[model samples]
Target: MTAIRANSLRNGPDEQGRFGIYGGRFVAETLMPLILDLEKAYRAAQVDPAFQAQVKDLGEHYTGRPSPLYFAERLTAQLGGARVYFKREELNHTGSHKLNNCIGQILLAQRMGKTRIIAETGAGQHGVATATVCARFGLPCTIFMGATDVKRQWPNVLRMKMLGAEVRPVTSGAGTLKDAMNEALRDWVTNVETTYYLIGTAAGPHPYPEMVRNFQSVIGEEIKAQFFEAEGKLPDAVVACVGGGSNAIGTFHAFLDDPSVRLYGAEAGGHGIDVENGHAASMTGGRPGVLHGNRTYLLQDADGQILEGHSISAGLDYPGVGPEHSYLHDTKRVTYVPITDNEALEAFQLCTKLEGIIPALESAHGLAEVIKLAPTMKKDETIVLCLSGRGDKDVESVGRYLGLIE
Candidate 1:
């Protein structure tokens, strides 16, 4: 296995600000000026000691950085192949990994003197995270979500509202995450002078993909240290679920140079083999296209209209994967797989039953992959899965599906 070295992020930007043809500021003329301003401010902030300290302090005190790399002994015993390790991001503020990027973007927005923040959410984790950061920083926040998601994830919608953010429902297209992103882009277009679009995923225009990944790389950094201490070396494999693939990228970044560590990104296999039946396996079924910002792996039609992605877990129901993931796939540095909704549900139930842990639906995709891979591997190997979010938001949907919704 050839290890994918993460050399680009450690270096300065190339002429076009790309991470080896994976990142570029592909945007409309209307947003170019504002995006350029953000790029300039972000560059300045990267060198500012005060800004660095502020972000670091907030990460420690607010978002609970350095989340534990806990060994799942019970899970390991049950699986009986590789030792199971979990990068517990579910314990972070807002109960998801989304807050890490949100905090950094909010601080950058503050440095740039932007007074308003806007975001899009599907499962509402990202929306809640952006709203939480805005509330902490005393900035006005607006979150756009699909009308369906707004209703399905009402608890998070309520959390965002309570945090003083205006939650707007997007009724366009399929009325989901993609539509929410479209609405957010429109809002940014209209309010470009005073608002900063805090994109939640790592798939957006040039700087966002790079910026968000940098903020999240802390996950891999911590995991690397912990894995060394625990196993006297690196893990044999690393895995995470992919929406726009921020969490997976973060977890995989540290292992890129390890050569022996196999990286896996589990895509949502919705309700089957047929993409229409159940799947959001962007890498498995998508083509290159432009959507919110950059050209990447997108589930689109012949006319280039984005398709509606489906998943039992709302967070994984995005129509695109990050550009970097597309690059990784092309380079054969990482393996991308699909976990069906049934497999995820089984893994979710199994983890809860075996270890008394209820993982987020998004994370369950990674767990589902473990259920598949573990049984076939030798008992000496190790697999570390990034549990990107907690499962509280999914209780209602799971309950309704199981006929337990009161």
Candidate 2:
């Protein structure tokens, strides 16, 4: 890996919230005023020292910042290639990296005098995280989940309910994440005065993609410092799973200007990429289109209607990805790979057996890519993988898949 001068990759979305031409406010006219207001408020909050201080304090004491970067000796040895490290975001409170952005947004909601919170979730990690924050703040929370997701990720559904959030099951459009997002948007439009729409990913209109990435960038910031302290330099490569791409973007942002460090995003390949409607490799299989308030690569047909995506990991089953990822794809800054369900499952079991870590199915996609890339690199080189969430919520699903449960 060769070093290069630092670049301005961080100054993204420009003034109109676009990463090149990939992102913009493509919402209904009724929602335009709210989006503009949010952009203004977010820009103000970015420079507010008091607001920054509060978020910092909560990150340290409440959500647990600086998640460890642990060297995976056993797994690295098994792969027999580059040294491997895990950024353990699964250890954060509420059990995933989703809380990082949720906490920041919740604080912003409070500052704006919002009284109600609404969010959409696919795998339930974000929903649970949002519900947890709302419970802590004593605010009413309503979570919209696709009916399919509610059934598949029932554990998280139960967790959200237990946290006092009203779980509304959306039955429209295949009953998945995209549908839930649509329902959340409608709810926000009707209740804009008192409701805050907390999006779970680094996708969505305007300030959302920018703001979520900013909040989640803490992962990359901590990684830069920790890797320097541990290995005395930057990593050779960084890898993470990309659904709507928040965790991957968070882990990749700090290293973007480091030309020597390669980046990889592993998308869920449910069965195989060749099987029709069988995977969620949006960048690989789809084309640019507008959906869910932004223009980006989408899985659509000849008539341009969005198609339902498939992935063993519910989180990655989406038809589109984050706009920044789209920009990165166009510029060749990152390599996006498709890892199939069988591949991810094998990696999941291997990580559990070798490292004693039960990774979420989504994180297993990253591990699968690491397994593929590590064996080709020199032993001295290093790869850092983001362990995005714990597998506790996935154990039952895995058991069912493996026929260990009735």
Candidate 3:
């Protein structure tokens, strides 16, 4: 077995603030001042024991940290050869793992004296989660999303509005998550003073990937502790869907040194393999390029025009991924694969029917991979899957895809 150091996994930006050729503050001159201020505040608050306590308290009392590690008895029996366990992040506040990070960021925003919060969301889980925290803290909130996402994820859009956030829809480009993110960046550049950009994923600039990862490490921390208490041994594998890679990173962090524990990140395979304009398998089909301030694997053309990525799950339809994921893929520490749309849809229905659990479309990608892999594994081998979010946001889209809706 290859011995690995846990400390080595804890990495940040270079002196110039880049994460393995990805991540850096890229904002207009106006926002640069605010970015620097945020960096200083976040760095300080990060080390402050009192601030950490506050974040921890919220995680326990409010957002419900240590979400259950449930043995998937039915799923295991169905697979017949392997045991499956689910880290029930779907039980967390707002019905997703997103709030785990939002709560931490909002607390940091408050500590930093930022008055408003801004975020870009695709499936709206992150938007709704951020709005929920904003309401909890009495902070103003704004969420930018693609017009298409707003229509497809209307329930969550309504939830955000009900939570007192202004949900703006961006109609440019493909009018999807990427365009929405670009619009949010523009908003940040213009309103950096009174607003704190509460990024939902680990794909953004420095401090964001590091900050969101720290916020999300709760998943790994809990799974490890719970595995010990439940099985007296570690899980044989950890699996998660990677959009911007936050959830995968969260689930994989603690297991990095456990050489026998495999890690899998499932990217959206949209329709199929990388036919031009078809898939969101960025890790599989993309090349390193700069998009939205970070140098990471991006689906772009030769001239650097970012191409629109397709996915059955809006959340997973991204052009680029977090740099750490890029690093892990390159180092072969983690295995990255793509799950096709039909496969994910089948998994979505199977989980709903078999386990009585309706997972978010984004999370269905991971489940689909599990469906393919579990039957072939050893009966005693355990796999822990990060159920990243609930499926409410995707019901309409799925209905439409199934021709149940006009």
Which candidate achieves the best lDDT against the true structure? 2
| Cα lDDT computed for each candidate against the true fold | 0.86, 0.93, 0.87
Candidate 2 lDDT, tens digit per residue, 1-406?
2244445676788788899889998999988998898888888899999999988998999999879999999999999999999999999999999999999999999888889999999999999999999999999999999999999999999999999999999999989998999999999999988999999999999989989998999999898889999999999999999999999999998888888999999998889998889999999989999998999999999999999989999899899999999999999999999999999999999999999999999999999999999999999999999999989889988988888999
Query: In candidate 3, what are the lDDT values of residues 16-97, reduced to their tens digit?
Result: 5675566776556676677677678888988999989988898889878879998878888998866888899999999999
Judging by lDDT, tell me the better candidate of 2 and 3.
2
- Model 1: weakest 10-residue lDDT segment is 1-10
Instruction: Give me the overall lDDT of model 1.
Output: 0.86
Query: Compared with the true structure, what per-residue lDDT tens digits does model 1 show for residues 1-406?
Result: 2333356324423556655556677778999999888888988988989988988898899988889988888888988898888999999999999999998899899888899999999999999999999999899999999998888888999999999999999999878898999889998999988999999988788788778887888899889998889899888989999989999988887777667889999998886637572578888888777777776788877888778978887788898888888878777788999888888888888888887888998999999998788877888898999999988888888788778876
Candidate 3, superposed: residue stretches over 4 Å from native? 1-7, 12-15
In model 2, the worst 10-residue window by lDDT is: 1-10
The TM-score of candidate 3 is: 0.96
Q: What is the lDDT of residue 15 in candidate 2?
A: 87
Ranking by lDDT: 2, 3, 1
Between candidates 1 and 2, the TM-score winner: 2
CA RMSD of each candidate after superposition: 2.4, 1.9, 2.1
For each candidate, what TM-score against the reference?
0.95, 0.98, 0.96
For model 2, the superposed segments whose C-alpha errors exceed 4 Å read 1-7
